[model samples]
Target: MERSRYLQVALEAAHAAAEVIRHYYRDGVEVSIKADATPVTRADVESEEVIRRAISTAFPDHGFYGEETGSHALDAEYLWLVDPIDGTRSFVRGYPFFSTQIALMHRGEIVVGVSSAPAFEQIAWAERGQGAVLDGHACRISQVHALEDAAVSSGNLRTLAGGPRWADWAQVVQRVARIRGYGDFYHYHLLAAGRIDAVLESDVNILDIAALSLIVTEAGGVFTDLDGGPVTLETTSVLAGNPRIYAAVAELMRVPG
Candidate 1:
């Protein structure tokens, strides 16, 4: 299939999931604790189902890896990564920070992505080799090269706070002009649209960051694991930023002896 078609399908899947999420958002749903201690709701499961159906109908041969439904054919040439609701806790609390995340990974590369924040009224999409778009306008990361002039955002820092790099993280906080924990999809969106210079996170699943990673990279920013490694299925940490800020942050995050 054409790359544009992949993005089209991803957007459609995100939209379909958004409908399910919005309905549950307004009407309310019961939450259950997953074994990982994260919360899940009917909205999450039903939304994944709807997204899966939409993608399957469009390309039955492709694989699927979803937060709710789990994986199928992960090694397939083409795979769909779905996160029905990226911020369930916020959604449950009516905070409107939740979103539907959908991405297509082709031959181990995330070639397309669609992030739809229904409640937030924001949508961003990207195709590999093409630029990113946020709400119908092309977007790019900020050019703030110096740490003292850059704004950095973080998410899910529990692991970082407990690890050897805790001081390194502190160094980043002390050096940057501003720091905010805009956790979940919001920070990535901000980074991609030139609103923020960088985003760091120490605990995340592939489903959580895959789409956002593509969005950031396509927006002329770099996306990598905290170790400065390429993104892959096992990726759990992130250090994303505009090219210059990314290099600066990545160097600061290196583990100290």
Candidate 2:
């Protein structure tokens, strides 16, 4: 299939999932705690089912890895990663920052990505080498070359406080122009659109970072683990942004305080 076809599939699935999310948005959806103690909602499961059905119908041979249902057929040439509702806690609290993320990986390389903030009516999508876009407008990362000039962000502070690298957060906080709590997929969207300069976080799943990885990199930014290594399915710490901020954050994430 053509690259555009892959992107179209991802976008369509994202739109379908977004609808499921919108239906439950701020309607006091029931929530349950998963084994990891993270909140999961009816909206998350329903949205993943919607995305899974769409992908399976369009490409039955492809593999799937979803936040709610887990993975299938990892050895397949193509894999779709889905995070149905990336900020379920926020969603449950009537926050509008939650989003649905979907990405297509071909032979281990991410090729197509889509993120939809349904409550905000904002969507960002990109195909490998095709650049990123927000609501059909081209998007690019900021040119802020120095940490002092950069606006940084990270995951939910409550979770980060428990992470092994919690102390590292202080170094970044003290150095950057400012920090925002635009947790989950929202940070990546802002980075890709040049609204934010960098995002750092620990305890992330591939489904949480995969789509944002492509979108940020395609927007002329860098996306990798805090050690400056390539991000993988198992990567836990992420630092993504323009190259300058990425390198600076990587240095801050170094061991031995």
Candidate 3:
């Protein structure tokens, strides 16, 4: 497929998601937990239906994966990843931080990523060779080079509960310049747009980070696991940042807290 087609797929997926999600705006829909214990809602299912149908019709042979419904294992030349409503909890509460994510991976690399935050009234997207853009303006990561100087964003503390990982998380949080608990894909969007420096979170699904991993990298940031390897669907934790800030924070990661 042509590179421009990647953008087309991503954008259309985002638009489809936004249209469904808007039905819940202001006074929002109630939420129920999925089998995995993560929240799901009508908005989620509605958006996923739109996205999945579009993907199926657009590329009949392509492999598709999403959060609401799991994925099929694939080594296909083209794979499309979707997160209908990435921040379902936030969506249930009518918060604007929630978003829809769509990505295209060609031969194991993310060639295009589109993130649309309807409440935020902005779209941040990018492709493998082209640099990232936000609201149609080109953007880059901040030039900050030191851990102490970097502004950090993280997920909810509850995601770290039910384990000894909380101690490790606390230790890592204390080392950062500042910590904001803006959960979901918005944090990564901020990082990509250079408004935030780094983000670390755990217990995420492949659909949650699939598009984001590429968006960050195209914006001149690094997307990796906490240990600094490539961002993977199998990873339980993820660390993403501008390259310089990532290196500094990677070294600050706690060992056993």
Pairs with steric clashes in candidate 3: none
Q: Which 10 consecutive residues of model 1 have the lowest summed lDDT?
A: 1-10
Better of 2 and 3 by TM-score: 2
Flag regions of model 3 displaced more than 4 Å.
1-3, 27-30, 70-73, 156-175, 254-257
Candidate 2 local accuracy as lDDT?
A: 0.86
Q: lDDT tens string, model 2, 57-89?
A: 999999999899878998789999899998888
Winning model by lDDT: 1
How displaced is residue 77 in candidate 3, in Å? Answer: 2.4
Q: Which portions of model 2 show Cα errors greater than 4 Å?
A: 1-3, 156-168, 255-257
The lDDT of each candidate is 0.90, 0.86, 0.78
Which tens-of-lDDT digit does each residue in 1-257 have in candidate 3?
13486588778878877877887766557778877778888888888888888887888888877777667646677888888888777777777878888888787777888888888888888888888888888888888887777789887545667666677666657777888877788888889888889988866767788888887888899888765567555766788888777876666664221
Best by the TM-score measure? 1
Q: Please give the lDDT score at residue 94 for candidate 1.
A: 89
lDDT per residue as tens, model 1, 26-106 = 676899999999999999999999999999999999999999998899999999999999999998998988888898999
Task: Give TM per candidate.
Answer: 0.96, 0.92, 0.89
Cα shift from native, residue 103, model 1 (Å): 0.8
